[model samples]
Target: MSLCEAEKTFILHGVEENFRIDGREREDYRPMEVEIGIISHAFGSARLRLANTDVLVAVKIEVDTPYPEKPSQGKLDFFVDCSANATPDFEGRGGEDLATGISNSLSDAYRSSKAFDLKKLCIMKGQKCWKLLVDILLLECGGNLYDAVSLAVKAALWNTRVPGVKSVGIDGKNVELNVSERLNDCVPLDVSGAPVMVTVCKIGEYCVVDPSAAEEKCSSAALVVAVSQGNITTVLQGSAGSLHPTTLMDSLGLGVEVANQLNIALMETLQSAPPHFDVGFLK
Candidate 1:
């Protein structure tokens, strides 16, 4: 993502004029396509394409003993795999650092109880709980990785269905549970407060949302804002250069506004998504 001095100057000028190379406004985002329930074997899955960046998220659930400290709450883990198919740089363990960063950001965003209710995943208080493993695969990288990954993760969780526990039996020192046999009886996860990330890139004196790879390269500093139901869940700064306090505040405001708008649009799209089909990279 290296850029020449002249290229950086050009991008800075474009930001000043409020016109990007892609003809989008500073606050506007690229076109996004979302598909849900694309994986049959998993409890739920979704694929999201934001321009050239592609992400796939799958949710798997398992019953296990609840954590001693948070007995009433279940566990949520995030695993990100940057496939080599996305780029040659991701071959072998080359992408491990990036994958770890993304996964850690997701964990921070969803750690707040206000963002996600883990208590609902508890099956029997401290005795049993449902552990959800959210696996994210980065199939492509065009930029704005944080935003794309968050959106795909939210969509997958929205489509996830947890089987209903019919009953729990205690015989001697053993405990057995019965799950609902009918698929329709399963309960869908509540994803109303799932976080959506918005990356605010500082180009010269102005800030932009959803920057392309080129724009990102020219950015002096960037903030990855995670918004959940109008409240900010996390704020992470990645700076190539220093930022003024006032400018940072302004960028935060812009990121929150854009993230709210994105969340609304994403919810509407998810509600109206078509039935599951085989539309992956093959399409």
Candidate 2:
């Protein structure tokens, strides 16, 4: 990921000319591929590949008591694992820091009620609730990890189905519940307001979206912007660098615009996707 002076200069000149080394415009994203329902055991799963960046996400549900304060709402948790298969640098516990950072960012992005509704996951006022555990596995890393992870997580949640409750009864001091026996008797998660992240990288005086590995090395500063339903849910500054007030404002504008477009494209692709087949890394 290190770039020499000459390589950095080349990238800077290309950005100034509005053409990247990969032949992409400033706001253009690399080609993306998405697949859903890849994991049979999990309630829902999805895999996304943006160029060389690969991410897999799965959603698991467990019945548990709701928190005292938020008894009316369910729980959502994010976990990220950077597999060593992606890079030798991630072996052992080396990837823990990176994984924690990504998971924290996801939690912040989904914290707002406008971004995701936990009430739909609630089964009872205080006795019981469904806790969603979103697990993200990073299989490969080319660049733009934040954007790819967010998209994959959103897609997996969209594909998740919660089984319908057949009945809820109180027996003694315990709450009893029965779930539907039929496999098809389930409810799909609503993800219309799920946030999509866009990483804006600053090189020279220009800003670029979806930076490749080389582009990332040349960046002085970067911002990861999360947009949900045309509104910004979170803004995270990444790596080491400082930005002027005007430059930061401009980057925010660009990030929001790019994120909006990315969200639309992802939704269309998910809707038009055909019946699933075995198209994992083997493909």
Which segments of model 2 are wrong by more than 4 Å?
A: 275-283
Q: What TM-score quantifies how close candidate 2 is to the native fold?
A: 0.96
The 0-to-1 C-alpha lDDT of every candidate, in the order given, reads 0.89, 0.89
| Candidate 1: clashing residue pairs, number | 0
Clash-forming residue pairs, model 2: none
The reply for model 1, stretches above 4 Å from the true place, is 277-283
Candidate 2 global Cα RMSD: 2.5
Q: In angstroms, how far off is 261's CA in candidate 2?
A: 0.7
List, residue by residue over 163-242, the lDDT tens digit for candidate 1.
99999988876668899979998999999999999999888888999989889898888999999988999998866576
Tens-place lDDT digits, model 2, residues 119-178: 998999998999999999999999999999999998899889998999999988799989
Task: Give the range of the ten consecutive residues with the poorest summed lDDT in model 1.
Answer: 274-283
Q: TM-score, each model?
A: 0.95, 0.96
